[model samples]
Target: MNGRLLTGYVLRRLGQALVVLWGAITLSFLIVQLTPGDPARLMVMGGEGGDAGAANEEQLAQVRADMGLDQPVILQYLGYLGRVVTFDWGTAYSQQRQSVTDVIGQGIGSTLELGAVSLLLMTALGIVFALGSVLLPTAWLRSAFQGVTVIGIAVPSFVLAIALLQIFSFQLGWFPAFGADGLRSVLLPSITIALLGAGTLSQVFARSIREVSAEGYVEVARARGLSPAQVVLRHVLRNASLPVYTIVGMLVGGIVSGAAIIETIFGRPGIGNLYVEAVSARDFPLIQALIVLTGGIYVLVTLIVDLSYPLIDPRVVSPAARRTR
Candidate 1:
């Protein structure tokens, strides 16, 4: 739990994440390659394959050669790994003029802008709701808050987004229906993203906190003249919160992957939109690249959360961390 130990633990976990990412990328490439699609034919549809039904064997072979598809899968994977380490993601086959890194880089930023802000919103609101549901003095207030949380959980993001658009954009004409521009544009989308996250997290955290509060440590703290707020903040909160932090990290990963629908509804130029297009056009390389990228993101977030564990509880320690401590 000491600073030195935490740092070492984080570093080790990062190394493991790297390995997991490599495996994910390799698997994604294998799946995409083995499946049927012709990026070259898709790119130059009218000129190359207009008369034909699809890319012929010769066309597929030529396309493969042009894109270095002739190289062994292992070799290609190694090359991809090397490029990824250097942040040099290859070019998209369809958008030959634009670099794949550039496209994904922009999309990642856009997605992050939406995801991070929404995450913050969700966590704060969820925690507040959890506190209200469990800690609030009045049963009626608790029931009302719980009802709202249930409603939030039931409403799907896209449906919510559309409804908000209708209410705020169509009816009120307050913000653009589909864009990530000023605060106006993000308002509805952010709300929709936060609602689902908060609804789920609040339910989880409220239950956790209630259980922790009833534990012996909480009773002991209360016995020792520590106020309810003090005990909850000092002992109960930390214990109940440790798991939530992990869930938060997983939620971040979930948001990154899960916002595709919301992003599509809002016409946000995020990775989700690209994912949709790639699937539609059967852009194997792009799809493979996205899969790898998303996996890497998930692994990275999970590692961060793992490293955060001991910090929240002084007792927990990993091997590298123990040595450092």
Candidate 2:
């Protein structure tokens, strides 16, 4: 790609990321605001409900004012957007007025650890499975890899989590069933999240590899006396990886969503677990912050994928393509 084309692509993707983040912020705010539950009531009741028939109007009003629930929705949303831009997520209602950032901070380490491990595992498994399906000598071996990919795609993360828990934790006692403590505790959940990603990614990746193999460049590379492995690895794999990168971008969102369920299932203390509690208690600020954080992450990952494309294969975003645009 021309330098100008790469620069233009980065700028374009940044603008799009901003749009996605703003949309996520707005939607999350609306969902929390428009939902039927009242955070003020939950607050006054100390995260639980009491005799709703016995509460006085004055008490209700105080709670609403205290939590800024009395403000107009538009004003609240604007103010929220402002605070988020300033990195002020405010306090968590369900956590007794603790800073939402701090609350998230406490668990972010665990989440990052889990996320990192999950990503590595997913990439490893996806490539191995995809390559095996494409290059394995036996049809049975290829079919087995393809079969497992299908199962991975078909099964939900929570269901897989439960099954793994029963088999590895409960039956074999090979790993802990729940909690986020040490490396061993992280293994099962990471695998659970990875499997979810690997399943979808492997199928797409395998197809991409197969398609790239048929491209003229691969034939040219082989004609130039390059070995089969060299033709596949240096030529085919690099070109084929564009789609896989897109899948990796999408997998971040899947991992985030799956982590929520997986975290709750495994009793791991992460942002996912906190999100569950915030939703259950109708903690507006916490919920909005988590949504923005997760959405922002997804957007950032996709942006990275978009930018990395030209670096990996300049032909994908050539000057000619930019000129046509």
Candidate 3:
């Protein structure tokens, strides 16, 4: 791609990312605001054994004022946007007035670690399955690989987590059943999340490989006296793998979302568990911040994937840029 086109492509992708982030932030704010039950009242009464009379008017009003709930919706939204931009996510009333950043910080590391491990496993599994489906010697073997991918896609994360826990933890005592203590603690959850993504990616990759294998260039390569493995490794693999990049980027969001359920089931500490706590306690700031964080991650990953196209294949160009030209 020309320098001018590349610059325009980057700028266009960035603009789209900003718009998506803004929409996500705005939607999260609106949903939290519209949800039944007052956060301030919830905060005041959460510790009072569910008694409505536990929190008086002054207490509720004070809590509301402290939480900026007394301000107009527009003002609150503007204030929220400012906070998000500044990375000042405010305090968590549900956590004894702890700073939101500190609260999230305590768990973000574990979540990122889980996500990173899961991503690696997912990518490796996808490539293996794709290659097996296409390169295996027998039809039944290829069919078996395809069947496994279908099962992986069909199983929900929680159900998979439970089954794995039963077999690996309870039955064999192979790994810890719960908690984020060490590497062993991460294995089951990561595997559970990886299987889901690997299933979709392998299917897409297998199709791409089949299409690429039919191209005339592939035929010429085979006729050039190169071995089957050499032609596949040198030519088919690179081209067939291009589409897999986009699938990997999209899978990140699923990994994070799945983390919530997997973490809860496995008793792991992460943003997913924090999210559940924030919602249960009506901690608006924490809830909104987590939503924005998840959305930002999705936007960033997809943006990176889009920008990488030209690097992966020079012939790749933005369709939007092409139209403009």
Candidate 4:
């Protein structure tokens, strides 16, 4: 694509991302509000109706009024939207008085670290396994790789995490069972995330490779005396990468959102854990921030991937270029 067209495409994707983010924000707000009972009351009572919650209706009314919970839902939503647009995420309701940004920041950094490790591992392992599955001469080896891929897809991440924990942490004592202490602490959890992503991608990559292999260019490359490895790497994989990239792009969200479950299973401190705590405590500001943040990340990753198609295959660029013209 020409520079002008590429720029327009990127701008269009960014605009769409903004729309999706707004929808996610609005949906999150509505869901949080629709829940039974007053959020302010729940925040104060810690989601419990016990002796400690002896405050009468009058006192609860006063609490709600103080928090602007007395405002109409639409007005509250509009006001909340304004604050969000202005980057004022408000303060945490359940924890020590801290800005919601600061609260999320703490966990976000750790989550990013974990995500970075997992993504790298997933991409590398996915490409390697996919290549091996198609390129290996032995049928049994191909079958074994396929079997592994099936297992990866069939086993839920949480279940895989627990199994990993039991075998590696409990019986073998290879790594720490919990806590994001250092590189060692991240290994098993990262593997858990990688396995899930890689498994799915391997299938995509293999299918793409198989489809590309049957194309005339692959035959032409072979006819030109390109070595098997040369044809596979230079032609086959390049063409196959479009689909692989698409899957990787989509998996970015899965890795981030799935962190909640993996983090919980591994007892790692991250946004997932924070999310769990925020929901349990009815922390509206924190929950809202997380929802927006997560949605933004997913949209951004997808946008990047969509724009990247042209770079991988000239054929993809032509379609977009034609549409623009």
lDDT top scorer: 3
What's the TM-score of every candidate structure?
0.84, 0.91, 0.93, 0.90
Candidate 3 C-alpha error for residue 209, in Å: 0.9
lDDT of each: 0.75, 0.83, 0.86, 0.83
- Model 1 lDDT tens row, 1-325: 3678667666777788888887887787676466655445664443322443555778667756645667887776676667556766554654443676777877888887887788889999999998888766789999888878986778877778888889998999988898878777776777788887888888889889988899987898899998767877788887898767877877876687667888899888888888887666555656777888888778877887877777676666656535654
**Candidates sorted on TM-score, descending:** 3, 2, 4, 1
Worst 10 residues of 1 by lDDT: 43-52
lDDT assessment of candidate 4: 0.83
Better of 1 and 3 by lDDT: 3
RMSD of 4: 2.7
> Which pairs in model 4 have colliding backbones?
none
What TM-score would candidate 4 get against the native? 0.90
**C-alpha lDDT (0 to 100) for residue 9 of candidate 3:** 76
For model 3, what is the alpha-carbon lDDT of residue 241?
79
The TM-score obtained by model 1 is: 0.84
Full ranking by lDDT:
3, 2, 4, 1
Clashes of each: 0, 0, 0, 0
lDDT of 3 by residue, 1-325 (tens): 6787778778988999999999999987787588777767776666333665678899888867755789998888887788789988777777777888999999999999899999999999999998898878899999999889997799988789999999999999999999999999998899999998999999999999989989999999999999866778888988887889999999999998988999999999999999888877777778888999999999999999988878887556656635753
**For model 1, what is the C-alpha lDDT against the true structure?**
0.75
| Root mean square deviation (Cα) for candidate 3 | 2.2
Model 4, 113-220: lDDT tens digits are 899999999999898888888878899998888778888789988899999999999999999999999999999999999999999999999898989989998999
Residue-level error in angstroms, candidate 4, position 62: 7.0
Scanning candidate 3 in windows of ten residues, the lowest lDDT window is: 43-52
Between candidates 3 and 4, the one scoring higher on TM-score is 3
